[model samples]
Target: MLHFFKNLKIFAKILSLSTLLLLFVIIVAAYSLNQTVLLSDKLKSLSKEEIAFLGVANEVSTLQLEKNIYIERALRLILKRKFNESASFFDGSEPVVNKHNLQLIKKTTEGVQVGLAEIDKLVVNLLSKQWSAKIEKNIVNIREDFNKLKGEIVEFDAKVQAFFAASNISSELIEGEILQLERQQDTIDEHIISLMAGVERLTLDIIQESEQLESSAVKRTVIFTLVSVLVGTCLAFMIAKNIRVNLNKGISVAQQLSSGNLAVSFVANQQQDEVGQLLRELELMSQHFRKVLSKVTESSMHISQLASTLSNNTSDTAKDTEAQQSGIEQIASSITEMVSSIQEVSKNAHVAAESTQHADQQATEGHDIVSGVTESISTLVTSVENTSEVIKQLAKETANVESILDVIGSIAEQTNLLALNAAIEAARAGEQGKGFAVVADEVRSLALRTHESTQQIQTLIRNLQQQASNSVTKMDEGCTYAAETVQRATKAEASLKNIASAVNTINSMNMQIASAAEEQSSVAELINQSVEDISHKTQLNAERTHQISKESHDLSSLAETLQSAVKQFKTN
Candidate 1:
């Protein structure tokens, strides 16, 4: 049974269990619903048919009693009227008494007929088939008896009406009519009792049938509910137990795998359930891990062997690298000394070039100084020539001033002759001539001073002209001297230019020598750098070889450790 459940899929297993429980629930619900429907039908019959039948029966019985009372009251009134020999038993009229009794009896009879009709309807619509036939028969009998009683009441009312209508009624006739009515009353009472008994009996039967149906329906519902509960409990326990057992097996297998036991065996049957599939996958995983571990073990052993061989090869290479490094160091030392000697030669050549440049600069400055002196001397000669021309112009301007002074002297002499003639004419005119003579005397004295002043001016002019002439001559001499000095300075400037040119030639040769020395220095430095680079590369190679040897030894150790770690996993 477990194997069958295990072979089912996970969904199918759960679905089967649920189906079983659901089936039980459906059966219980269906049965209970059916029972409830039966009970409900019985209750509906009791409420709508059986209970209505009983109510209608009770109403018929009451109406029958009312009819009998009305009939009896009518008979009593007729007896009273017969015994008392009165015309009416009530209201002072025999016809009125008879009509009142007939109206009451007819009303009660109509009510009884209506109740019987309702009872007949209840019996026709009865839900209980077993009671329908018997109840229908009882209602038919009741209707027949009620009909005969109604006929008797009508016949008695007619006779009473006829008796009351006769004005000359005999006592014996009255007695005979009364006796007949009494007999009819007895029959009516018997009919009423029979109708009531039949209705009561029908009511009792309906009650009993309803109670039986309710009891049976309750029993069926209880039994089915208990059966469903029991079946569902058993199914749930079975499905849960099956699943738990399989899951426990899967847990055991997982525990073993967790402990790193790759060699542990897992066996599974052809179960398609979830726990079964999980166990199968675990078994596959264990097998795959076993194969991987086997390969890793073999690879680790091979790695250890290769690491040992690498260590030996690196050691031999390290020895060769050390010897090569020593030879490179010796060659580097010789090249370094050669580079130092070339650097010293380059330094001395650079100093000589700088000294030559300084000498050329001094020679150029000396040439510039001689040229500046020559320009100054030429400038001075031009200034002296301009000053000599200015002095010659001053001498000519002084001669023109002397000629103007001579013209002023001649005008002064003409005024003196005019004043003398005025004085002589005043001597001839007496006192008037005396006044004219005084004015003439003052005029003559002014003209004489003017002539004397003109003579002094001509003399000063001559002195000025002579000084100007002397300055011209002195400036001419100074100009000649300046011209000679300028010639000497120009000759000196030419000599200095020749010296500067020779110094520049020597500076150019020195620059060429310096440039050649710099080229040689650069070439020697390049050779020295090549030697240093080779020495550095050789030293680096030796160091790297030693590092490789050490790393190879470490690699062998790591491979052995890896092999030991892999040994812990049992692959076979």
Candidate 2:
């Protein structure tokens, strides 16, 4: 008996050790799974925050792009105008250069604004004063040179005219001087063409820089997202693996014990030191399991007898519950059929009410459209009246042009008279006045050409006035048609308003229909609630039936135990 007990102790130790190890493994596995879940949740939260931060960074990038575009445009405008002077932009600005932009974004949009403002002010000042003076001086010199050239052209024209009169002058000599004058005019035109080309090249360079900055900002955003994802993935994998390894060690110990090795124990070899104390506790519990189990076996045998009588009673109870369960199932089926019928009727009523409301909204939109059309037509008529007034102003400007032309003609006549007097004085002065005589002749011929040009311009102005008068007549006819269209549109709008008002009455009727449908829906909901209540009561009954079935199954298990105990006392 001692040997038997000794062997049993060994067996119980093995079995209990197996059980404890298995429970520990299960606990560890559950703990590991919990840790993985927590880490996964944390990673998800971090990813969301990272994504939100990236969005804010992207917003800053977008604002930076807008600022860059503004500055580049302002700079190009300055270069295009050929102004090279700078002006200050520091006047205690709202988005200060050294404050918000510098700190938050790590790039200064306000600094760029400051630079651009300075560039723009410089351009404005240069264009206003220095460039203005340069252009004015150059224009004055060019005009003076052009007037001299014009006088020379007139003298040459006169010489050609004189050559037509002079029988002694050679035609070759007259043609040679005319060719020389044409060559000089060509040289002056070439210089003006070169000046325009230089300004165009400077404008193109500033636009290219702005495009490069925007492309760079987009690249930075893509790179930041990829790096964040990679870091989160690595961190999640490391934490999950550590938890899983600890759980697997406990499972290995449980498997060894279940194979009936009494000496089975976990090797608590972790550097963390928590596994050491847990292994000692498991070892001590295993040493005493056999003694406790022997006492429990004796109690189990006595309990087995009581279970036998319960098994027979449970068998009788099972037959009764089957019939009750069948009846509850039939009641649940009947309630489902009633709910289906109510839903079908409610759906049809809802569809009809929706159609009426949609028709009302359409009528209201039509009224608004007709009203908009009337307002647009009225605007067109007003625009035509304003255009007629502008044409009248054009007519007045044409009249002014005619008056200026008349003044120019009178000035040319005076100039011609003065030149003739100078020429007469130079003729009396003899050899000393030869240059004076040439200048007087040239001025007299230029005056005659100017007088002719003025007369031609006056004739053109009169023709323009006649055309403007014809345009005004056509505009009046267009205005009259537009007024008629507006009147028709207004009448259409009034009709649509009446239609919309009628739709309102129809909509009100639809609302009452909808209210009736809602009442029907409420009744259906009550019926559905009653059906659900029936279903719940039926489910509760089913659950009670299932509980009875479970109790019967337990009773049968106990009855087997009772029968075995009763057999132990047989033939006493």
Candidate 3:
């Protein structure tokens, strides 16, 4: 019942402990009370029985004194020749002695009783011898054989009277009678002495009996007191130790939680008490949190992968755009050179026509100018074919870059999904997941940034493709202009000299477009490097999440242990 109370609610536990202490005190008090009653009874018995025993012993002593006084009186009477009076005194003292002897039998033990019996026998023998001696003495005093001598002796007796009775006897006869009387008196005195000795022996026996009784009583009381004290100390120690154990368990739990070491294991107590219930609930909560963190960690890893792919595609697209811009500038420079050759061709043709006086020489000069024009036109055709090859290469590279960007965008979308899952998990974990959630957010932001950079690279790639297409168109226009200049150099020389400045302006604009594309490619490379950094961080975050999951499992195990430990206490 006490165990049941101790495992109950807090208030009940305190009450139970207090009740146990009170009960212990009550038990000790009861033991003392019982001892007290027993001692009181023993004391009462001692007061009644022992006091009565002593009183009887004292009465015996008083009787012995009275008998001694009576014996003295009896001896005086015997000396006066009044034997009857002495016998009367002896008889009067006998009752007191007999009464004392009988009382010893009633109040005292075996040894005192034996002495009283011996005293009674001695008193009877002494009285019997006294009677016999008294008769003998009287016989000697009377004359029975001679009648005349009897009458004369009677007359002599009357003259001496009772005063001379002791002297009239012969010296030898009187001495003999006195000796016999003295022997009888000595026997009586010895009997009185033996009776007094018996009384003293009885008193000594009573005293020894009282001391033994007192010693026994003391021994019993002391033994009981010692047992009670031992029991009380054991009860107190057990109660104190029990409380200490429970308090220590509570402290251990608090310390483990504070350190973020959820993996602490202890025996979970089976009791359904308040503390047990609380610890059990905590274990369940930790388990749930651990599971949620696991899923979040998996999702974060998937997002990190997508972000990496996006960075790769954006960097590839930027390189291709930079290549296409390089090709357009080469084509523009070819167009400018072809135009300069046409101007020179027109100038030489005019010089040849001015020398009419020397027709043969002028015709020869025109032929040489025609040959130079044909060489210039051949170079222009070669430049146009090379620009067409460059445009085709730019188109192919642009298509590849676009495909890679599409893949990056798709991965970015998937990362967003994983980030969403991580956020949900972090929310469930509450305060514990706050730091993890921040990392997840960073991953999401990097994914978005990579996506945005890919989009910019795509736009730039598109612009480069457009510029490449325009350069092809310009190359075709340069072809037409080159053909027309060839025709005009054959037919006339004035038109070819007019177009050299336009070719110079187109070449300058192409160089500026290549420079801008190079700058854009550099920006894309920087974004790709940032994506790599973010990917590395994401990987680290995933690892940390796994660690957290493992810790959560440990916490769950600890909760189970705490539950088991708590079960040892009986709540029922």
Query: Best lDDT goes to which candidate?
Result: 1
Q: After superposition, how far is residue 229 of candidate 1 from its true place, in Å?
A: 4.9
Task: Give the CA lDDT, 0 to 100, for residue 189 in model 1.
Answer: 66
TM-score to native of every candidate shown: 0.46, 0.37, 0.25
RMSD to the native, candidate 2?
A: 39.5
Question: Could you tell me the TM-score of candidate 1?
Answer: 0.46
lDDT of 3 by residue, 107-144 (tens): 43333334344434433332343223333332222112
Candidate 1 lDDT trough over 10 residues, lowest sum: 123-132
Clashing pairs in 2: 304-561, 304-562, 305-562, 307-558, 307-559, 308-559, 308-562
Regions more than 4 Å wrong, model 3: 1-239, 254-268, 272-572
lDDT of 1 by residue, 155-260 (tens): 7557655655555455677678768867876776676567667656766666676677668877877887788778777877877887798889999888888888
Q: Which stretches of candidate 1 lie over 4 Å from their true place?
A: 1-4, 72-98, 127-204, 218-241, 248-252, 266-268, 294-562
